[model samples]
Target: MKTYVCPACGLVYDEAAGLPEHGIPAGTPWADVPESWRCPECNIGKTDFVPMEL
Candidate 1:
């Protein structure tokens, strides 16, 4: 699995550790995330996120 980072607020979204707080289950892939989902910290769209390097 991969991880993504919100460029606006530096929030990290890990595919292997899905954001269950926001209703995304564990193991959810980045592409499976909803288009309407926004960064919890910055309130920006998914487009504002970039692939994060491990």
Candidate 2:
């Protein structure tokens, strides 16, 4: 699974274990995640995140 991290606050987002309570189910790809879904840690948008690994 791919991983993404918020540049502003270093919040990690893993596709293998998505935040279901936040409306993002597990296995949800980063590209599939809605633009409206902000980082729960920093409140930043997905655009602020960058791919970390496969």
Most accurate candidate by lDDT:
1
Lowest summed lDDT over 10 consecutive residues: which window, candidate 2? Answer: 45-54
How many Å off is the CA of 17 in candidate 2?
A: 0.5
List model 1 lDDT by residue over 1-54, tens digit each: 999999888999999999999999999999999999999887999978999988
Per-residue lDDT of 43 in model 1:
97
State each model's CA lDDT, in order: 0.93, 0.90
- Number of backbone collisions per candidate: 0, 0
**Candidate 2 at residue 34, lDDT?**
90
Instruction: Single out the weakest 10-residue window by summed lDDT for candidate 1.
Output: 39-48
lDDT of 2 by residue, 1-54 (tens): 899998999888899999898889999998899988899988998988999964
User: What is the total number of backbone clashes in candidate 2?
Assistant: 0
* Pairs in steric clash, model 2: none
